[model samples]
Target: MKKKSAVLLVLSVLVIGILSYIGAFGLNVGDYRVKSFSQMLSKGLDLQGGVSVVEEIQGKADNTAIEKTIDLINLRINKLGVSETAVSKEGNNKIRIDVPGKFDKDEVINLIGKTGKLTFKDPNGGIILTGDDVKDASASISQETQKPIINLELKPAGTKKFAAATQKFLGQKITIYMDDQKITDPTVDVAITNGQAIIEGSASLEEAKNRADIIKSGALPVKLKVVQSQIVGASLGADALPKSIFAAEIAIGLIFIFMLLVYRIPGLMANIALVLFIVLVLFIFVTIKATLTLSGIAGLILTIGMAVDANVLIFERFKEELKLGKPVRSAFEAGFHRAMSSIVDSNVTTIITGCVLYALGIGQVKGFALTLVIGVITSMFTAIIVSKHLISWAINIGLINKASHFGVNLRGDNNA
Candidate 1:
């Protein structure tokens, strides 16, 4: 039964793999050969020809921070109901954003382009400050009233500035600005000594909740100017997917073969993990309706390589376990456990990179970064969970004998 379950799992993964390659578009296996590579998948802005918008990020440049801004921009594009949008940042203070053509180009622009504006005001109501000076924002409640509010903390300089503003505007409005646009206007009743402030103007339950979250997530530190914007046409996706997939396939193939040759049995499991990793990642992308921009495709390919690297780590550890003459199951388990540390450390580091790219990178690079992050996460799952399940299954099926566990050989390779 255990072997059967594992076989079923492998079969299920195989079906998913075939489907992903074919995509959601109606597939006639007979007609599959006749279809152009373009028909197999969607295109991004660069390929389809859509609008690209470049903007200036406006302050404090950490490569990491800038990358995160880029990721956020891509998220906005995703919300606009388009897939394959490109969003990234330029130099120290600018963002480059793009997406494919749409009938409502203006709407897409508005959706992807706005800076998050969140505000708060004093009860007496006179202007104080906005999200611009906030060093951080988070969800909390007023100490006195215990009502939900977004806590806003200003930068050191911003703190002094906000304190002064609150002192002067006591009994007045302190509106939050997102891209110089007002979000919430909370009232300030007294001078605030702490850098902390609260935003109290959510119009609805959901709105308030969202405002609280935005505050917690922290708003864009500075104002951004949209330097450029354009809607790309549909033709781009057709052109891009083929090239992207071709690159990804070649890379994955090379990695698979390399693993098999270098590590033997363990390498085979890693390769299987890699394929499952790809399937899960793409499945998430399509389900999430992520816009598949050119940079996004590039990110996906990059993740493919990383996923294989994760497998390699595990397989290498398996070698250590085998050399110790541990039983097959014990060796497999030990190797997986040992490899887990490397896999996690590497993936976490990459995730941080992705987060930065998402934050400040903007446009297509942002897309790539977001996809890369997602792919990394999904890779971890397939590598740790899916791969283990497969190996355990093989052992259960009597695929490996007592001698086979240590100096073994098998017919065909799982990854191949």
Candidate 2:
């Protein structure tokens, strides 16, 4: 392909990607996008300004319980169709849940606050008590129906109690209940003196599986204290978007035009790479389901500035090569190879900081770190692979014949 054509194709792919994101194009590879880059990244409650909940897990919070609560948070977030919502430990005994976008917050709070009581009943819809009494519960697939179901092995107390309950309800319908709600009612054709049981509800696979998970995870260990609640009016978000767009466009446009005028051709190439850097980052965020927030947007902007750092380094080296009277292609290669050390050194430090923040930080801090790290890594990729490839292809096709044009001097090139 001609150099211009190749670059155009890549750019077109990028434009389509953005269009898809804003709903201008109607194309869905499907949920989870096992293969495509459309990750189910949703926002955290903090960014979009939803409910901020503080639950006090008082007096001896179990590690097991904390882990289970995290799992439950994930489950509920998934149910809400918000992807990878943040639920993390705050201090020692507090767990903070941030759900992105507005949700049925009260309903969710109730579901999360309950003890996650699980029960089993005979087909007769009679009560067969299960232990909180539930030693442990799991989600599995029924072999006959090939669908998801909940599996429970009652504790000895629960075992004996369940056995007794099952025998009394023998040859009748027994149903499983979680906090007084029937989960599944399985008929007992014979006595189940043993302590094993399965509950399958005729529902969609995802619904059954999620319900089973909710029941298995049990209730949140501590009663949640609504420490704070903030609602971001939709009007505010609408107002901010145009300004954000204006800022992004101005920043990007200036960088591109400056690259062409100052660094010349290679600078233009770097600018192109920078644009790719942004595209790749957004693409990944969508694929991973990273929710954009005010803070997240700031992180992205900073990341964009940082992305140019690597390219600036590369272009400087390329200029040095050109001034030294070496081949353009070789200079491009050397520029990238030699500048790599500085690039690695700088980004590695940022990444380390990101890791530290992610480990110790909660809420928006983590989101910033995540996006920052992702941006740096992808910027490096585009710099090394995407940027250089474009430059080399252009050279091969004779698009840039002179060093000055590729450097800080060009004719009719208004792009910085």
Q: Can you tell me which runs of candidate 1 are displaced by over 4 Å?
A: 1-42, 53-99, 102-241, 263-266, 402-416
- Each prediction's whole-model lDDT (CA): 0.66, 0.68
Counting clashing residue pairs in each candidate, in order, gives 76, 25
Per-residue lDDT of candidate 1, residues 179-225 (tens digit): 44445667777787788766675555556655554544444444566
TM-score of predicted structure 2: 0.80
RMSD of each: 10.8, 4.9
Q: Once all C-alphas are superposed, what RMSD does model 1 give against the true structure?
A: 10.8
Give a tens-digit lDDT track for model 2, residues 261-301: 87776676777677667767877888676777666777888
Best by TM-score: 2
At residue 42, candidate 1 shows an lDDT of 55
